[model samples]
Target chain A: MKVIREKPAVIQRPHNFCAGCSHGVFYRLIQECVEELGYSKRQIIAMGVGCNCNLTLSKIDTVDKFQCAHGRAAASATGIKRMRPDLLVMTYQGDGDCGVIGLGETLNAAYRNEKITVFTVNNLNFGMTGGQMSWTTLEGQKTATSVRGRDCAATGYPIHLPEIIAGQFRPAYAARCAVYDPKTVAQAKKYIRRALEAQINGEGYAIVELLGICPTNWGMSPVQAIEHLQKKALQEYPLGEFAGGEQAELAFLRQEAEK
Target chain B: MQMAKKIMMKGNVAAAEAAIRGGAEFFAGYPITPSTETLETLSFRMPEEGRVFIQAENEIASINMVLGAAACGARAFTTSSGPGMALKQEGFSYAARMELPYVVMNVQRWGVGLGMLDSGQVDYLRDTRAGGNGDYRHIVYAPDSVQELVDDLYEAFDVSQKYRMGVLILSEGYLGQMMEAVELPPFKEIRRPDWGLDGTGEVGLKQLCPTYNMALAHELLPVRQERINRVCREMQRWESVETEDADYVLVAFGLPARVCVDAVRRLREEGCKVGLIRPKLVFPFPYDAFHRVNPNVRGFISVETNDLGQMVQDVALAAKRELPQRNVPVYCYTHSAGVPRVQDVVRYYRSVLDGAVKEVY
Candidate 1:
């Protein structure tokens, strides 16, 4: 018999994430990409607050990881990468950790074009904290605090961080991908690999926003949550690379001027 | 005897150069009053020495950067003042809990919330105790002058890693800005600790804290207590002047201590038995020096530059602990924001001698 599929050495045991949650899937995808791209031994992850820290309990067998303070993973990764440029530094954060409280740190890291990778799990709400309304929570979505449903007029619209980062700042790579289905999961894997390669090539900062479905938080079955993420969340956060191309931003500027 | 080369420079620049001499490879900080020179000097000096230096967007980012560097076992630090240091308490607490070694030079400003830029000792209580949340203690060094500032900061890295804890250089605005002739320490090459996360997964998995650390907290309590006790036992340092057979002793640190030295001399010349005890290490409180003071000492005067006198309470505690048999009176004299005037400190001592002022403790 031939070996068709096997778990990477980076992931030594089953993760402790909720059943049917996309966090474990994205975790496996990242480990697989790290194993595939040959950075299995030389990558450091600055893990942020929120469910991202839950990965610490997953018994990651190898690869260095620092559970950074809330909202400061990008800044911490800056120090790790700056002190030792030989190592690949990355940040794993949640929507609340990266797009809300850490907006300043995340944006400043990109503004400086620090040579690091950022992977944010956008599950629409703050999952680990009993499903509070997060920066990425869509309008009309009900959360713990927004029990009446998120009112855009009052709470404002969902923040598109990757879009904001890619549209304004100059990163080496910036893309958003969903993991609700097999094809989308494969697409997420490619974006994850591209973000990793961007750092390995020393091109500069790279970011990939992974859209995850929190079935427990969304109060839906695994199947229903997947459909909701695809049907509703996808509209607010489109999947594509927001940053890339030779002088596309300049072209965008000139085209805006003409319009 | 060989003479070390001496140069005249400001305290902030001296701290920056001394950090480099102390084997500090990374520095992250935001520009704030008095302490800004340290950040400014290192901006160019770090890259010139092939080291890392970043002017982060804010103090939160700066201290977290220091945390990351220290997590990698690299000697790193950040410089800030009162408000900025308050901003850094979270990162400081994280570094303390992680048992990571780093240093912070807090050139203190007086008051709260966008405090004045003048020199003061308002942070004396906060820096010696836990500045952030939780029950943890880090080493605090108080220097009286520019030369002492250079010396303390030079040895900060060694002392921090020796105990695997953070170190705070409790500097004052006057001391950080004043120019003085000082001999900088020699540039020493030290090896980074091997237990840090090198990011080479070739080694065993190094979880840089919290989950496993939280689990280990119960087991780590006694270890932390013993470590702190050991630090307190071995790291007590201070200057004792005419403390033998004196009737009263003047206790102070940093810039205020400089004036206390003068007050002590003037009092001694006037047929008075006033002595001086200047603590070099504020956290340990120099209880050992208090122990060796005149047994017949009538009172202890604490000179400070902050409102309501912060260090006076510590002075009272040390006095009460060292001489438990009798109730000793502790008087406080605060110059508020600026440096204490020599005459004011002397007059305050006179008032204490005359029993015109009430004892605070």
Candidate 2:
């Protein structure tokens, strides 16, 4: 079979993410989206300090990248987008980076309707620092910080960033998707593409939260991690476009459902 | 005699106009007391001049906005006072270490932790001596007048770009809120070189900042630090008035320096041989200026607004560097309770002259 889509040449190295890690999946999707949309040259990605930070080490020669202070990616991206509105600006962050440490910056970016794209990956735990309890870790999930399983009473519940952001009217697009299965991966890419489109169209503030998998951190096999995502992560974070559809698109969908 | 137009305005407004005149195209700031006029003026005027101005959600976001804009090679700036400056320290340090050139105007309000809206010297160490974490120093300037504020800020952008580091204009409430006539400089076009990330990324232009990889830092930091040290050494600036044949020299900066100058002139009229050494650039604490003091000078008095006499420590260090064995006496006449009084400074000089006050250091 002739290969219709090859690996993006921009990502030349063997990815440094761990086995069953969803960061690779998201990074590949971002590369493909940028490549297909022909924004590879006019794009700048602000990388947050997290498990996905290794993405900068890959040496993507075409696209510009900035290493942001931990949890300051949205604020930094705000600067980049405001200064160079001609260029497409985006920030890639993890749950702890956005939801916990940088929640204020993320929300304010939405409030200001900054014309930028933000991709937040929720892998249920902080996978880079040997799997600590992240802001998106489930109520009962076990990790390095919560060895005896998380207690919602003390640790609080996992934050659903997509839902929180979608509730805000300023964002041109906001969505939550996953990378557990091929079908879900396609949904993730669609949402990611739409988020980028919002930025391209000059619609302000686009965010997409991707439910990622971390097999090593979760202490499970790669297959088990996928199953765990499907069973638990999806149950909490249903895959759908929470925002960004035009009124006409919604009207058409409603009419089709009536038929 | 230069044909420059003079305008009557508040010092903070003068600073705002000076920033625009200095080719600063981007500004992001949080409105705080004593510094709000700068932001307020820039909000409307910046967009009118086709520049970017943002009333950031907070000081942290404001500095980050500057960091981002500076990364694009645009001349960016921000203004804040005490608490707000504290919030901006993280981004300031990041910019310093990344070698990103930008300007910061700190219209200092009197406070440690929200103390007062009046002018007090609380951030002497915080502004000049490594305000942020880590082992890095940036250029710091304290102007004594509205004209000096305008002139120094015009050069501050150049110094910042030349050094590729953040430069701070430490304006206190006394200067920021005071009304004075300032001659603003003419506009100059700024040039952005073929570097930075101003959307030429396809040709492979990149700006790296805030490193965490210790291995890469270990190899690169020492060289970068050596370059910074050399620049700091070259940029030492101070104003020494009448120390040629004096027995006592008063060390001060900013508002205190203005007061000390008045006190020194009054004491000279009273047949006392006193002088003033006012530091313009506080960080590259002019150690060589102390060497210029006459051998007959008996003591160096630091008249400051901070109660702890933070600048006195630098004065001692600089004095010791010049007179290691001679024991040049360093004394402090601080006024943390309020602004420094010329009478108090004059009184302290007389006490030193009369051998009534002993030099502790």
Candidate 3:
């Protein structure tokens, strides 16, 4: 017998995203999770502005997808979750979409502990909008709008969303992952899986912020961008779990179920 | 079968009861004059009925919460007056863009600022045409009587859900505060759509919320235009009284519309040919229906209670386009900063009919 292999569910066509953009890798990881968890058929992927908006055109099997107004994907996701709680719901948003325009809805959802997962790709700049500085834009990063390196004194510091959400809402599972290298990509997969698992267990809100690399926007080659992310960005945004006592809670529930 | 009971109730209370009878499961709002009773009534009744009722941090939060709940497949609603309505505009626009079905009751008071908590239909301009951003249209109902208010509430929810759009119930301070007889309807269980975000277990579906998408915007213009066209085609309704033989048409809505009816009767008694055309759905503004009336009408007297003549402009535009050569003069009688009485509208109608009044744009 011959075995036929295929690309991961996350990989799709009309790939207009610039080369070395982490969006493709993140998409693959998310698709893989849905396939592994048996949620593929019951999942609805909400794709928001920036690079993630391309997900709407992607042909991901068993996952219905739609696009919403900029910065409002979280609120739409909230509506979707309320309307169809049985489906595995997730939103693919960028830093500008999640951290800026959608800040209110995002924070409110976390506070309310809505049962949904938000996969936020924080590349420090609004990559899709001609590399403008975003809420998560690194202090010294240069972009189209910020011709001079980002001024922390004048523009305020980068918003550490995971830390803010963890401090305030304490969601079921919250973590920051990176996609700078193969190892971090694997680590990001774990965090994404954990967040989805939390939703499956009816634990609460889960958010995974991936510190991705936007090579084109950053004015660096793909390899150099990865190295830059590892050397510069990683220091400011350390990877780790920020909230959710879900691991302990899940264990307790399992014990009780066994009993 | 249970017989419906008729009782006099304030417009706001009737609006609240209508929401409950319409199977509204979640309500979030902040207290504002003339509209506070809606939140108060829901706060007590919702919990008792196993519905979710919350007093949100502010008008913005309240609308957002309702949007959240409505997205989750609950029949959701909120109520407010002028200033609060202004604050809720952003959320309202998002709700429309996302295509969430819910009810918003604006118990109107004078505005542009901190206009007194008096009965006024000035919000007609803001709420009717484009209270929110985008080219999307909202299903609007202006109720004069408490019964009409209740009836409109039920219809508003049905229209909202069927069309996947926001519905506005435009009432005024007088309607919100005045007591009137209303017949109560039996409660029915609301069957939520499979798409709402109640929780993970109930519907076995993912909660979808609205997000901004620039890529979609590239192709959004045509798609949005089509939606607006469909809305215009399907959702326009109007009510007219003594329009046949009358030479003058009085255009109004909500309490002002009710006053126009009295003005029409008085004008007829004074041997002037006058009639009234009341718009039930303000957004898909009933232009075609208004055009069907006799063009022999001399002019239209727009009675509004706002300083800025908003709805009057819509009426004038409609009249000019529809009945261009009826010698139709558009007269604006604005009770700026106050509600116009029936006698005041009758006086305006008489002047317009007798050709004694100089048209004020």
Candidate 4:
């Protein structure tokens, strides 16, 4: 007998995201991974003050969810893990929430190699705040704050988070993925599963940066948003496991050889 | 049976030791002037007791860590001075809303906006009145001496948890940096709460959410307000010395209270009718203690090391409740950040008694 589907960790509740928002896909993928990993009963999540974060509390009533101060999900998660190391703890943050305002907490948590998972929904702009320029906003991209297209000179450049995490020795896993289409959605699921697995195994900090869609904030239709991710986001933030590059491959090879 | 050893140590170190004795299993703190030794002591001592200690990246992170640990049923605390305490306001507000019981120490310093790293009590208003924005109040204890600092911290954990609120020990640098011999309390083993967000993975049990946003506002706000009011009423603690039989009452707290107490004794020895009323618990202001004073006490003088008396308002209000018929003279003698001069306090008490100091209208 083959099982094609299983229940997810998220409870059956209506989400509050805008139509065509990719946050729903990320949420579903994360819940599926949690359900598969048998962490549904012992999962604790720290939610950032953002649109996607709000849905996790309202929709995902099954798991314990803590609401963190804007951009302080990492710090709060660190507290949970330190106090209750036996439990699985993770944080859900957005581009502006994780990258700019809470960059200190985010980076320090990774540097400390805290045994937790961080899932960042990078939508290029601050979606909940009506499309303001974020640290992850693309060059030449026009947001409410970046009226004349983001100037590379004035706003610097979009921060490459996975690249930065990969450069660090603390994070055992760090990857960038998108959830635009069916294939990419499946790939995003794998990234989320692997990140959770790393935390479960106490392999130090793990992070998965998901290039999510904000159709309303981007001023695009569902189709246009998918196209933008496929064409632009994928080019700028390449999808792959950036951190734990050699260690993960070697472990995989060793396991295959042993088998 | 062996008695506890009394060792001469700085007030900050004693505070750290007292926290450990009080069963604080987790300490997340950032180093700041006057209060740094408290964190430094806990950094090494906490781990020895199988506790968690983290020197956080900043004050903001430290306080957030406290909120996290406290949510999971761990006794956690943090210590800082003026600038660091200012940075922790956001986390404190969150802790108050979530009702995460913990302790925070503000070793007072002079000035505002990166003020000098010396002894000062100008932060009395901020520390006792709302340190953070909101209609929330913290259980603030102003310990005047090294022994009082250790004693307050020793019982701070239970008191904080009893009310499910944050407790603050507002000690100035003079006490925090000074050394005194004191007996330490025995270690306590705190029982874990049944309702914690640790996700024990047990069946038929739901995970707990510590933030107020997750709960319905209309349902939670009223309950939270009621809990706060009840706790405030039950946690009012203070001390009144010679106030029962005196012509004039002197109100002071923290470091200045020590000076005022000494000044009162000296004034009494010199055949002057003066007494002291010191508030151990600054928050909930100990209004009942003022009402207990002799109605014959014609005046009240508030002595503080802050710029233009902060606690004077509370003192006057308490006195007003005591004597509703006639206007009682309330005088404020402020010294800002400078070290207290006992002579100055004595002179003010004499002037008020002689009717030389005009009543503050």
Candidate 1, B1-361: lDDT as tens digits: 5788899999999999999999999999999997999999999999999999999999999999998888888999899999999999999888876888899999998888999888889998889888888877879999988899899988999999888889999999988999999998789996777678777755422334433267788886786678889999999999999999889898889888888888888888888898989999998789889899889899998888888888888899999899999798999887899887778988898898788998999
Fnat (0 to 1) per candidate: 0.75, 0.60, 0.19, 0.59
Candidates sorted by DockQ, best first: 1, 2, 4, 3
Residue B120 of model 4: what lDDT? 82
Q: TM-scores for chain A, candidates in order?
A: 0.93, 0.93, 0.90, 0.92
lDDT of 3 by residue, B277-299 (tens): 88887787888866777768777
Error of 3 at B334 (Å): 0.7
- Residues B1-361 of candidate 4 have per-residue lDDT tens digits of 8998889989999999999999998899988988899988998999999999998899998898888888787888999988999999998888777777899999989888998876888777787766677767788998888889989998999888877779999899888999999998898887775656857433211323333554476667776678767866787778788988888888888888888888988998998778888998888788888777778888888888877678888888888886787578788887787667889898877777677877663
lDDT of 4 at B157: 92
Q: Give TM-score, chain B, model 1.
A: 0.96
- Which regions of candidate 1 fall more than 4 Å away from where they truly are? A245-259, B202-219
Top-DockQ candidate index: 1
Error of 3 at A58 (Å): 3.7
Question: Which 10-residue window of candidate 3 chain B scores lowest in summed lDDT?
Answer: B199-208
Better of 2 and 3 by lDDT: 2
What is the C-alpha lDDT profile of model 3 across A138-248, one tens digit per residue? 888888878899998998899988889888876888899987677888888888999999898999899999999899888899999989988899889999888754455
Report the CAPRI category for model 2: medium
Task: State every prediction's TM-score relative to the real structure.
Answer: 0.96, 0.95, 0.84, 0.94
Candidate 1 is scored at a TM of 0.96
> In order, what DockQ does each candidate have?
0.68, 0.63, 0.16, 0.56
* Superior by lDDT: candidate 2 or candidate 4: 2
